[model samples]
Target: MLDLQNIRSQFPILNQQVNGKPLVYLDNAATSQKPISVLNVWEKYYKEINANVHRGIHTLSQLATAEMELSRQKIQKFINAKHDYEVIFTKGTTEGINLIAYALGNSNWVKKDDEIIISYLEHHSNIVPWQMLCERTGAKLRVIPMDENGILQIDILDEWLSEKTKIVSVNQVSNALGVINPIEEIIKKVRKNSDAYILIDGAQSVVHFEIDVQKMDCDFFVFSGHKIYAPMGTGIFYGKSEILEKLQPFHGGGEMISVCTFDKTTYAGLPFKFEAGTPNVGGNIAMGAAVDFMNSIGISNIQKHEDELLAYGQKKLLEIEGLKIYAEKAKRTGVISFNLEGIGIASDVGMILDKLGIAVRTGHHCTQPIMDYFKIAGTVRASFAVYNTFDEIDVLVEGVKKAQRMLG
Candidate 1:
């Protein structure tokens, strides 16, 4: 069991007020609150060693490089990647998708008439990159459909997996609905049927689940740091070592080259080939602290705590009349997206909830396809984190009722 009081104490941001009431942060699906340890990492980096990483002999520069690379080791071990070089540092999940799409499509690996499959549950970050890639390479994009319950139609997996399928990109969890996707099962099928590369977007799932890229057997996996209690500007892209060696660089600049020449330039091996420009050294260093924070409490403990939050939040939410929670039947994490039956504007509901010191996300949540599938504009998403409590959820229930009364 997690020590709720101690966890809450680590996040000083949780101890605050909004609209003259105690803040109930339920927008964790958008981004998580950073703990004091992560904050201190940032402070220490800038104060003591603020220097660029790689090819530097100075003490501060060496320290910064060591810390940044240490962050990579932390991530590699965290995800159980076989080799540390397989873990390429990225801006976040979005850039990671964009990198792979650009590299594969441009390198003649994914040819014309080749297929790329994603799902209806994908964020625009996942969709738009592949769409751009398809437009450039003449590859076609296919989507796995989701039902009204917000669950993927697994029966159609065999149909979607074609010999022409070059890449199959799916999320481990849905950001909009909070549904836990059967990615390991999905990957097994993708491998058996097609000679396709698999990419699992773990932006929503990473903090709440134990991720082992080797166990999942995906060619690529991506997640963001800010979603997992780390600062913005840090993220991970884990690719198979052999697969990464086959791909060309997505960006060209100083560090990515082995030897620079006017005529021909040989690229660096593995990670440095892809990393290109000077990275976010400080942010990556602080990311190590975030990983330490998660490990200290144990991911299993955090997962258990968040599971309780999801259940309790759902129970309290269903008590309200006309509040229809999406994907209630699906296996989910610590997220809940719902809309009032008669009330159309999810934006207005969010605004009213804000007045009561409840923080929630109100939009299509970068998954307009999901909104279109549901035939609605958007939803009000109340996502929980480890620091959130059942008492905070009570406030959300009361706040929702208040919003309905006021909006009605």
Candidate 2:
């Protein structure tokens, strides 16, 4: 029995109007709106407990360190990771993937001629790392193709999984087309086909669905905090204990070193080994608050509400003449990437939407590879969050209709 009206009131930014019209934030795929709870925690930390963590004996230091660890525990519970140390904080998904790629590539596990498989629907963050790793090592990169509907070709993936494939990284959900990948089933199948390690890009999935790394049994899972209603410059990279122990450290600096001598140096353990330099203390702590906020409201509630919004948006948008929505899969998220007929440029349409106080993302969304596969320039994307409502969709529907007439 979650109260949607009460929840909407927690976001202060939603109260204002933009461009002389009611603000309609539909670009949630880029980043979500922050609630008061998240902002309050950040403000409290800066005002009260602003101190470096895990170093000093001062009371402020202790308080900051405790808060930081509490955040880790919260994240551990959020994704159901067995150990808190498995969650390593980084900048965002881009950094998370790069860390994995470099760490695994430098190890003996991923060697020359070893194949790393990624899907065609992958963002540039996922694709380029493997490409760089392949270039550095003599490892080969394999791509699993997608159908016209933007669904991954399971038959093709089955054929691609072989003994030489050492790593398989795929998005838990496609950001470009709103396609919810069958990651659990795909991971299970990958295990049977080969002993390859799997990493799931959970950027879009974490915000929209319930996630359990233990149940998913993925070797690594990565996501950004910004997309989950937390501050920017914070992300999580969760590696299985056994797998984490095998990979080399990705970065080296202050907190990550255990001992440094003239002869040799030793590294720290688990998460500290990955977190280098001064971590984003405020952003990391705020991420915990974000999880707390989502959990308090219930992830199931968020999913159900978002699904309802998506359905309402789709039905409403269909009423518009010559509008096309991508993907009709049973499993999907709240993202809608579309194009209106006779619209010369997606960018212009996006500008018009902005003029109407409707925020939407345009362009390839950093998945230019997918755009190249489909032979389309880009799409105008409108993704929803839990706070979104049917009324917002009506505003967007009217906005699109107006754009259609104006562009024509």
Candidate 3:
């Protein structure tokens, strides 16, 4: 069991007050609060040994390189990747997905008539890249539809999956609704039906549970660091060795190339080939610290605690009259998206909550399609993290009730 007080204490940001009341931070899905351990790692990197990695023989460079590589290995083991080389440092999940799409577009892999599949649950980051890919390659974009309850209609894949499908991308957990997608079943269906590349967007899911890229059998997996209590601008792109070897480099600069002659330039090996230019060495090291922090508490323990919070939050929030929770019936992580019946505008409710020292996300959440499906502009979203408490949920519940009373 996790010591809630001890865990909460580690995040100094949670202790402060907002709008004259104790802060109730429920906007974790946008970005998580960094713990002191991760912040210290970031400071130590700059204070002790800060230098460009793999390019210098100096002591500082060597030390920085070692620390960054150690971080890579930690992420590798954290996600259970087959090899460290399969893990490439990226700016975030958006860039990683763009890299894959661009590489595939440049290669002969995706043809003019090929189809790329995504679902309604995808973020704009996942949707726009494939749309751009389709424009570049003359490929068709297909979508796996979701039901009224925001559950993905996986059975539709039987008709969608065919020889023409070249790529299938889906999120393991919906960022907007917090619904846990049946990606294992989706992967199985994709493998049995078509010879297509599969990419799982794990930006939200990685924080809430254990991720095994090898066992998951995805060709590529990507996630952002800020969503998982690490520093911003740090992310991971995990791809199978053989698939990574096949794709050409996405960016061209210093570190990605072995020899740069005027006439010919040979690109570097697996991970570096994709990493191009200088990386976020300090942030990456801090990300490793974040991983260590998660391990210290244990992912399963964190999951259990968050699950309890979700259940409690849902039960309490539903007690509010005219409150409708999206994806309430679906299995979810620690997120709740809902709107009060008479409120009409979600931002108004968000503003009311903000004045009460509660932070929640409003608007389409970069998921306009979902909003369109529900025939609403957006929903007020409250996402959780390990440091969050049951009392905080009570605060949120009361805050929502206040918003409803004021608006409705």
Candidate 4:
């Protein structure tokens, strides 16, 4: 019942040729290509509803405002937030985490000498904000160790978490190793010991799963728009209703305040209190359209299709001589991280793959701690999506074979 060919047709970018060969875009963990519907929304906004939202009294202003709020509602249902106000528009996942960190840093919940815990598999976006918070507030940064397979050591978290722990921030799925973490169990355990807030970096997981922040009961969650087939310069930050209401405002400018009198001005309500200045109205509107497109296709079918692709890719890549696949666990995402034997280095292998027109990511994946643990610079990553097909994976495997031969 899942029409993959028809679905692929909706994405025009996937049909293009790259480097005189068909583009095998496997760098989905980096970002996803947008669909035609998403692009059209961008054009339609500027063409018809070009005006500042929530301020102008004209017809264009009303239309723009309506469309903007419609995006908020769409995101609300996407993540199943308790209220639309709980969802705040941010620049991306990085900004979202920073907003929560800064807001909590100023709150009485966290104090000097307190501990904010993170795991080794976190991206720099999740790590650095807490590190900076620790420096400013005298809070100590605690790291949860990962196992040899790159999965979070959930058993060790019981010992790591204590009364001193103020927050426990981690990724739901590792961008580098494609390991989907046991976040629900971790959250339930953390709650029994301390009132530490939990933030899930869903930049990778959101694309592959139907996220329900309310069901998960996480204190805060963040993800990027571009990762979920939306445009750049757009992202979402979800905080619990009570949690968001108590946090201090991070940015201050024109639209955030209710009435400015130079003498103790009162800030606007929940969402506007956090969203300052003019937002990317067009990008956010497009994000809503992107959500509509995905809903029409259904996320369950997408996940099923991707799971098959991942299994096929893993099985085929193992057949290649002198190649080692990382994260050989059953519960992994669509990303396949591996290294070619006899290749000088991952970078060299990546260069060869590039020459063969196979696009993939080769680096630390913004996860330096994990690389240090593995004692390797990085691995070559080929991540898949709904638009990707088995034929493309075959092309990628052949390209890797070619790279191995040339490099050896």
Candidate 5:
């Protein structure tokens, strides 16, 4: 377990007041608050070495490029990607998925009669890109159905996998319900049964778990830096080296090309081929710092501490009359998505709680299909982080109860 007070102290934003009460932030699943360590490195990068990467003869440019490449290496080591060239920087999970759709799908790999499988738990980022790919390739889209309790119906794996399956992309964890999907088993099954390549969306994962792409044997893994307590507009796109070489460049531009002419062009090697133009140099450096900071505290410690809090918080939430936590029976992370009785809209409850300085996310959470499946408009999601405390959970419970009375 982590030291709650000390961990909370590392985040300067947590020490402030909101609406006459101390702030209790529980919207971590949307985006995490950065610690002073991450903030410090982020600021330091711009202040000390502000330069465009990879093309200058100046000292700052060289330093910036070096740092950016080092960040790639750090991500490679962090995720256990086989090579530094496999880690390509992108804007975030959305862009990462789009990159794969264009780069891999357009290579004629996913043709007519091919199939792409995603699940009901995907964020729209994971869903929309594949939809576009299917439209482009004439490939059919398949979905892995889940039970009412939100556990994936992996028992029906054989029903989905076949020789026609070309690419299977899925989330490692559900951002809306916090249900951890069994991606490793899915990958192994797909590998044995079909030639389908797999992509695991780690946007809501990586932050909570230690992942080794090599061990998981997935062909691709995409994640957002902001969800992992790094800056927005920063992300990592990891692909298998062999598969990456087969993919066409997602965009055409300067840095990604090795030789350029009006008639024909040759692209750069593994990652740079996909990384097209000027990249997020400073943000990538800061992302590396975020990875280092998480390592210092340890992911296992954070996960275990949050698991304890989840159990306590869920128990407390269930005590409220007519309150329901989605996916309660499923093994999950530190997220609790719930709706209270007599609350006409989830946002009404959220706003009332916000007045008491309890911050929670209230929406479909970019997983509208899952919301539709549950027959709800939305939910009030309380997502915990390492700095959150049992005391804070108590305050959240009381504030939510107050919101219930006011709304009722």
Candidate 6:
């Protein structure tokens, strides 16, 4: 069990009030509130060791480089990558996915008529890059369909998987519906049926549980640091060393180069090859701090607490007169998406909730396909974090009922 008080106190933002009421922050799916430790690290990096990394022989540069590399090591261990070199830093999950798509498209890995698979539940980040890749490479994009319950129909992969499939990218959890996809089964099916490389978008899953990349055995895994209590503009892209070695670099610049001449250029090895130019040194170090913060409390405890919150919040919200929860029967973590019947739309309900100092995401959540699948405009998404409480869940429930009464 977690000491909710101790955990909550670490986030100073939770103490503030909004709209004349205590803030009930449930918009965690969009981005998480930075903990004090992560915030302090950001300040500390700039105050004590602010310099461009891997570029200078000065003490501050070395310190910044060391600290940033230490963060890389921490993330490598955090995700259980086989080699630290396999962990490449990026702007966020979107960049990581784009890196993969761009690199693969440049190489012979994906070619004309090659197929790439994604799911109907993917965020635009996961969807667009592949679409662009298909456009660039003449590859055909394939989608795995979902059932009425919002669960992925993994069985259909039997028909979709083929020799021409080159990449299979999917989210470990649906950002829109909070549905946990059967990635293991999907990976197994891909391995059995096709030679495609599998990439799991761990942007949501990383916050909810421990990720062992070696165990998961996906060819590539990507996530954003902001989703896991780190600052924005920091993210991780983990690819198997062999696969990364074979693919071309996403960007050509200083840090990712081995030798540069007017006539010829050679790229650097492993992670550095993918990570080009200057990076968010402070943010990446703070990402390491965020990892330390989660480790101190233990990921399992955080998962358990959020799971409880999900169950409690769902039960309480369902008791309302005319509320409909999407993916109600699916296994979920840290998020709940729903619509209050008779309300004008998710945005109206979200505005009402905001007036009560309760924050929730309104609209497609960058997932228009999900809305189109359900035949709805959008949903009210109340996503939780480790610091969130049952009382906040109660507050959210009451806020929803108030929205219904006012709007309906």
Q: Find the candidate with the highest lDDT and give its number.
A: 3
Q: Give the alpha carbon lDDT tens digit for every residue of 108-183 in model 6.
A: 7988999999999899999999999999889999999998889998898999999999999999999998999999
Q: Deviation in angstroms for 22 in model 2?
A: 1.7
Summed over model 1, clashes come to 0
TM-score of each: 0.99, 0.98, 0.99, 0.98, 0.98, 0.99
Computed on alpha carbons, the lDDT of every model, listed in order, comes to 0.92, 0.90, 0.95, 0.89, 0.91, 0.94
lDDT of 1 by residue, 1-408 (tens): 678999999999888899988899999999999999999998999999998889789999999999998989999999999999999999899999999998887677798899999998999999999999989888899898888888888668887787898999999999999999888788888988999999999999999979999988999999999999999988999999998998988999989999899999999998899998889887888888999999999999999999999999999999999999999999999799999878899999999988888999999999999999888999999999989999999999999998899887
Write model 3 residue lDDT over 57-107, tens digit each, in one string: 999999999999999999999999999999999989999999999999887
Candidate 4 wrong stretches, greater than 4 Å: none
Worst window of 10 by summed lDDT in candidate 5:
1-10
lDDT of 4 by residue, 1-408 (tens): 678789889998877787788788899999999999999999899998889988999999999999999999999999999999999999899999999999998776778899999988899999999999998989999888887887777888788789999999999999988899899999998998888999999999988879999899899999999998999999999998888888888888889898889678788998999999999999999999989988988999888888899999999999998888877773799799998765636988887777767789998889888888877888999998878999999999999888887778
- Badly placed stretches (over 4 Å) of model 1 are none
By descending lDDT, how would the candidates be arranged? 3, 6, 1, 5, 2, 4
On lDDT, the stronger of 1 and 3 is: 3
Deviation in angstroms for 114 in model 5?
1.2
Query: Which pairs in model 4 have colliding backbones?
Result: none
Candidate 2, overall lDDT? Answer: 0.90
Worst 10 residues of 4 by lDDT: 340-349
**After superposition on all CA atoms, what RMSD does each candidate show versus the true structure?**
0.8, 1.1, 0.7, 1.1, 1.0, 0.7
Deviation from native of the Cα of residue 148 in model 3, angstroms? 0.4
**Residue 337 C-alpha lDDT in model 6:** 97
Off by over 4 Å in 6: none
Candidate 2 residue pairs in clash (backbone atoms < 3 Å):
none
